[model samples]
Target: MSGELRVIATAGHVDHGKSSLIMRMTGMDPDRWAEEKRRGLTIDLGYAWCTLPSGREIGFVDVPGHERFVGNMLAGVGPVQLVLFVVAADEGWKPQSEEHLQILDVLGVAGGVVALTKRDLVDEETLAIATEEVLERIAGTVLAGAPVIPVSAGTGAGVDALVAALDTLLAAAPAPEPARTRLFVDRVFTIKGAGTVATGTLTGGCLSTSQTVEAYPTGRRTRVRGLQTHKHDEAKACPVTRLAANLIGAERDDLARGHVLAEPGSWRPTTVFDVTIRPVRDLERIPSRGAFKVYAGAAEVDAKIRLLDEPFARVRTAQPLVLDVFDRFVVRESGRQRTVGGGTVLDVGPPRAADPRHRSFLARRAAAARGDLPALLIEERGAVRADDVVLLTGGEPPTPHDGWCVAPTVRHAVRDAVHDLLGAFHRLEPLEEGAPLGVVRQAAGDAARRAGAPRAAGLPDTLLDLLASEGSIVRTSTTVRLATHRVALEERADDVRALLERISGEHEALPPTVKELLRAGTPRDVIDAASRAGTVVRLSPDLVVAPSLVDRAVALVHQHAADGITVSTLREALGTSRKFAVPLAEWLDAQGITRRRGDVRFPRED
Candidate 1:
């Protein structure tokens, strides 16, 4: 059986033996810079790996511990699950140790093992006292109850015990599930033959050679030429492990350390985002407005903070970064040069705080557990495309209602609005059988936007069909109406009867014109209502005739079945003038009752 692969990072004060501990355990020095070895300090991030006793392959990210290199430290620890915390036995806990612990706690590192390095420099009693102090300092931190093993990198004593502890901790760590691939580029450089190489901790999903990837901030598309982990070439790289990908189609100058390589179109880059934050350590305040640096993934951005309410705030960056909800971030007061706090991202591309729905949405997010947030977001949105839900929340939509994740309340509201709009349309134009399809779509789209489902604008055809399937509305190929709606001329019955009598009895073959009807005391609406009721047919803007006259016209055309009928022939047959015959012939052709060629007509084959 193969054990799991995991990545762990080291954190402590400057020169606290974090690099030395990794070297002793992994048989490879983590400090890669020549200056680092000569200066006896780790400067930038370093990487090394080793297999544990249980066969689990573990990678170590060695981070700089100096106060000035805290940004580098944050980049290393931001994406990993386990921590190898180092506190010198002689020095116990220092300023950087306190700062590092606070950072780990806020960033939500789930598991840890504290290393009491340089144990050989202190006696047994001093070592015991140092262990006690470290425990007290980390009591309420993420490393609480973590094993503190005393070790000396020079003599290699107790290094075995620390390794065993790490293996045990990793054995209990949750396994990484397959997901969308995201690799924050912590290191970018060029090789002799490789065009450009970017390295970072891989998370979210897997990366394989020849796959297309996109870089954030730059938005450059590139392909992976090759992959490597622990100095060995690999065809694929998995999550929660350090990875270096040789990229094609991009110059080394086009990439940078803070950039990210992800599956094309998998991430959205935004300069502004919302988060729920808590102050770190004894810090009691997070200023509503200030210059701050946000450290997330492998990116550090300058930003301005705005407080919406307690624990809820918005940060607008000077440049864009790829981010997701539930991602952890650390914030440092730019001027003070100290860790202020960190938080979990709640929303990316949030609406203005002044928007009416902003606070209410945040309230629901605050009340939801991490796993429940995606579903809650979909519910709050009313309806969203299933693909969009995955992109926005990094989780699948609860259940797609015909490709849209719909909330019951918002769906009901939209349905009601559709009914109301159709009702208004019927009241205004009672002579029409139903509303035009385009008009109903426009009205339904407005209602959906108001109900919190912006993507449902124009109310997709599928949703319209769904509404019809539920019997909320009746729809034809070109029109829509409420199921309960019907066209009725009962209130205009007397006027309709008068209009029909004038058309059928007074002017049967050549009915009265629209102007003539009005002059003869017939209201225009009554004429229209009679037409809708099938008592009369309006063949033209000015011509109104009884349906019986149309039947007679069709009978006359059939009487000439031996030869195709002409407009002149129909006029003579009906004893009417060419004015009525021309429109009547055209109407027959349009309805496919007759097919016209030039001036003659023939019965349609239908």
Candidate 2:
């Protein structure tokens, strides 16, 4: 079985000859369990394969048709794209047949062939009526145009025609997309000496021997020790086919039917997601609340639904599942024991609240095609790391900027917010040269939150630096300011000038302390503005002096060439107390104008 591989699942009611039809088509027994063989009922899934007349291979996944085993049937058919719908000619249409049809339609099965088996049990007139009933039942379904073939496994009649019809369906089927590798495990067991083995339909990409894969929901890593498709050994097996992989790193107890084996780190298991759900064809309305089980890719878990808007809801699963956007799923009410509705996954990560902006984002995702979703994510998220975009969408981001995927509109909004915040700061604090970097960052974070994009709060620093490099803002070592922002004296010009004159003249040697000036009716803003303008120098938080006085002190320190000056000598020269001289001398040392050696000070040499 080479060329190309296609998988098709058999679906119908119990005892409708689904397994018998597969046995006739492939010459193999589909009822794997002994109880199933004795009871003549498919209790679980079965597998068989054969090559068609066109040299194309087809794998058959036989699913149980009993209403009690619908969960088993869903696991078998969830990952497949085509179905071999069976409806016994004598039984006509049963309850299970309609349920199976609904499942296939919601799963997005592309095309199929309806097998009206047990042809010998019914007369020609009866068979004609039964076929018409099936046709009417499938009027608007995905299999509306499918060919209905009458076949008898006991008499071996019409079997050849059924084979030919399947060949035609396979020829017209679209080629599988080359996506990341994903295999849903419907069966997990330990093969004597080969360790743990998992079997399921591989749909995403190809799997090669020795490839590393991770089990989802558990995140256990393992290596594919061996690969087999239809019991034939191969180094690499492509998708859209049934595969049995021999695994090495996990025990049989660690893996289960609902678990998934995927490429290492390629998938993120999620507990909550947004979806566009619709009630089953005939059902009027689905339950808005209560526990339901979500079935997707051979996995079923208890879930709770919240209606965000019409046909859109948020599903919170009891257990994490490896689900992606656009993946089809079925929701069954556990209490009623019926599939109420099904839906397409729209978002794997949704905000906590269903705000208006979030609702609009979901609407766009629902309307856009698969390839256009990544860009929509960027637009809604405002900004995301480039690598994260790939991990989320399985594709490169659209028009990345500086290694980040960003929306231009949102970026512009954040920039405007930054400018407004800076302008407000300047108006309130004209004495300060600029806002502290930490304060600016806090403002940027607040602005981002107001813009409804808190995840992009770290983006402000990068944008701020970019703006500074482009000459839009002035960025210092510790502060940020608009290019046009400047500290202005304004109405306090005369007060600041008078303070500067007092510091350089009468109080040149021992300038008034900052606390004293404030007590004498000198506004702190005026004193701060003069200090920022270099009209006065601050030796400490409480001390202020004239620059001319500092120059004189430096000259006196260098005059003592033989030895560095002591604090007491500096206090005598300045005619001030130790409080002012100690801080002033420390300030000179900090400025590299003089060096202190224990109790002495010396002029620094360049």
Candidate 3:
């Protein structure tokens, strides 16, 4: 494709020459770990970038096929857009290949170019049979319609065709969506002259130096020391380019395969997963509700399957759970001990506690799939990406046993969740107007689900409209406030009218910033709420002039300057802190009660 971003991986059982084939194809080494080259088989994930015949360079993540290192495989392939399923013609699809392929299918790795390595080891007929067997294994799967080619890593028989096919596949790859930011970390090493450097494909999202970001699971925050994309130093990196970010603060040991670099708060760690999972055909029987090992993203934990309607088991983690699946998840259990068949993630955090007696989750599960899982996860969690959804869901993305519309309902849930939050406010403190939109949105989502809204989208607008119309909503010139609650600095509706009387009379020339008044022991939220209630107007970011005080201040400034109120006059006039003095003058200028011309400030009528 003209502007495509390609991420491919190598898979097959160990000893199938996945590393050698890569070496032949790109002339780049994949065995960086000392033990890997010594063992003569890849025991970890290795990464490289190669240019296709078309001159389009793409990233290739080489993962281990050994059963012990499957977790490592999950991390490498988690972010890839394509796969290079390598099955030696002699060995065919072995345990490692099947497992890795199953993971690819579960992780939703689509568009693969199958390479039948070691073609020289077998007769033409044997090669055909092995190739046929490999095809049959992947048939009806994501790797089903993938292109297959034969090769000899030793003789380079079909290496040329493989590269050509890669070129064609990459040429047809779709352009990476710039809308959602994504980064896949593959290499973390200390530079000889520099410090810690992380190399990976910048799938989406932009990365630049001096930007603040956090490393997940570890909770270590750091700044980008420098950025390099496509082997060239850059001030910032755009999506779809291979990136090597030099990091500051984090020790080299603090980073690992499972560690994710993301925008702060964009991705969180999740325990419970509401997933749509499926049982492999080989399952001797369906698993009952109880503990089973769940593998996702880069982590795996023991979980209990809470099968729904008995259509599928509901998986419960040792802690809070978040992966969701219906009849469609690729779930495999070996006596409820380990997860062998992993499935794609549909929705990360739905209700695992959903009463299996009713068809509630079943009703909305299908919609979540067709609707878009990535969109759904971000909408509900306020997280920025599907990985965050993965973090929220507690696993890699869940593959739907059936289709779903997780996105639309999630958006609907946000509107309702924020609204009902207001209803709660109306009850707890009827005198209080409302809260901020961010807080409200989160509360509403939880409340809506609790109220049997089916999904977030089912929330009613009566709740949302009430918030907006009531002016209960506080807004920064930038952010929305459907959920962030506020209170006035001064008592409202005549609560302790004496305080306002004093502020109005004794301090006519100046006012207090909410922070300063808050020092007197009033809670910040309560102060903000009162301000929004119009008991007091925040004439400036810091300055708060009570409704009763504005008039006297106008009269006094006119008395003192008549011409204008300079900084010194205003400071001397208010006995308040500097925090309030500068802001009070600015507020006066805004009210059309005063205008600042050059160094002198004067009062002016609208």
Candidate 4:
């Protein structure tokens, strides 16, 4: 079986043999710059790869170790899972060694091997002492129990043992799982024939030639023209492997060191994140409320940390970082060059609150840390999109209906609001069918706000539709009401009903006007209540007729619909004058029951 690929990063003080050790192991110069070769130091990130005795391919990232280039060192070590920590045997332990170890610990690197280089310059006894010092230094770090191998790059002593140890270390490393692919671009340059080439340690998923990708935080889109892994052309590059992608449609100047290349829409940019932090044990005090630098996934950003209690804080970054939940980041004091703290991101794009000191805001932060989707739903108090929950928690998508996931508590709150609003409206206007749909939505929003619940904008339509579908409420094009709601008329309703019946029975085509009813001492409120209750149908401002009479007139129009019916024919059939016939005919036209052509009317096809 073919062996899987793994990436290992080199770290130590300047001129500590990191580059020379990689050159000896792989027989390839990791320092690509001519100036670096002349100065005998690694200036930037360098790459080389070799296949071990077991045929397992190991990629190396040679990083600069000078104090001024610590940022460059972080870029190399941020994404790799294994480290090859180099320390010159002549110099037992150095300042950069401690700094690099702290960084590895901050980044949470789980596996590593220590290389005691320059063994030729030291005796056997001295080499043993150097090895013991290195072991003591890494005793409490991520490399606590890692093996130490003494080797000399100039003489090739112990080189084979070092390679064999690396193979063993890699055999126990976990295989990468398929996920959203993210390539933190550590190098960007222009090739004569290939527009822009970007190289980095690819993680999360896979990349293939001809696939489209986006440079996040910049949102620049480019297509992959070709792919290379370990200097060999490949159709695809998998996670945890070194990759160089030739891109189309962009210039080299458009790309930068901190930018990330990812599949489109797979990642989102966030300026503020909620995180859980662990201050370095040696720090005198936590830099809780000041400017700091954050390093994560090859991106270094200036940020401000606001402590929200112990161990929990909010980081506001100057530049947007593409991150997911549980991603690790290191924080360093601005202008101090010292590691202060590091933590895992609990939430990207956390919810905003008007008052940070509010208990609800603190509760929301706690909920985000625990990744409790149900708690978020309860806090939202309404329907939330399943996609949003997945993004927030970095977990499986929640169960959804009609593209919305609603917690049972929130769903119950909406249902109760609807019920109470409809009950109050029914009590106030007993003769009416229900309240207007807009009124119910306004009430629901107000109740949510008063209860400190999450009020999603434009969610009432979904709730009402769901309720209506389940038979809890009655929904129409213009109104909503309880399923059991019915019109309840007052004591004076009988008198008004008697008047409407007499008028429609006497004159089937045109009944008494609203003005006539008010003039005859029938209360206007009573008339309006009757109209709203569907007992009386108002065709126009001056025309009020019984619903039964309107149905008869519609049937008459339908019978004559084959050709057309004239106003004179309608007037003669109903025994009404032109004064009443004109308005009734116009009302029918407005209702789409009939279409008028000249003085004749025909039933509307629609």
Q: List RMSD in Å for every model shown.
A: 3.3, 5.0, 12.7, 3.7
Question: Candidate order by lDDT, highest to lowest?
Answer: 2, 1, 4, 3
lDDT value for candidate 4? 0.81
- Report the number of backbone clashes for model 3: 86
- Candidate 2 per-residue lDDT, tens place, 1-606, comes to 367889999999999999999999899998999999889999999999999989999999999999999999999999999999999999899999999999888888989999999999999999999999999998899899999999999988999999999999999999886566789899998989889999998988778999998998898999999989999998998889899999988799989998888887888788989999888887987788878999999999999998867888999999998877888999999988898889889888777887888889999998987788778887777667777676666666776556666566665665687788788888898777788888777666666556555456457676566567667678787888899987887657788877877787778887788998999878898887777788789898888898987887887898885788888888898787898888888998898888878889888887
In order of TM-score, best first, we have: 1, 4, 2, 3
Which of the predicted structures, 2 or 4, would earn the higher TM-score when compared with the native? 4
Q: Which numbered prediction scores highest in lDDT against the true structure?
A: 2
List the candidate 3 regions with Cα displacement exceeding 4 Å. 1-4, 177-180, 184-187, 229-231, 240-242, 284-286, 289-292, 310-339, 356-365, 369-606
Q: What is the TM-score of each candidate against the true structure?
A: 0.89, 0.80, 0.61, 0.87
- Which tens-of-lDDT digit does each residue in 94-211 have in candidate 1? 9999999999999999889999999999999999999999999999888999999999999999999999999999988887755677898899999987678999999878889999
For candidate 3, lDDT tens digit of each residue in 287-351?
A: 56544666543344566665555343345555422123321233445353334455444344555
TM-score of 1: 0.89
Error of 3 at 567 (Å): 36
lDDT, residue 361, model 3: 43
Worst 10 residues of 4 by lDDT: 353-362
Better of 1 and 2 by TM-score: 1
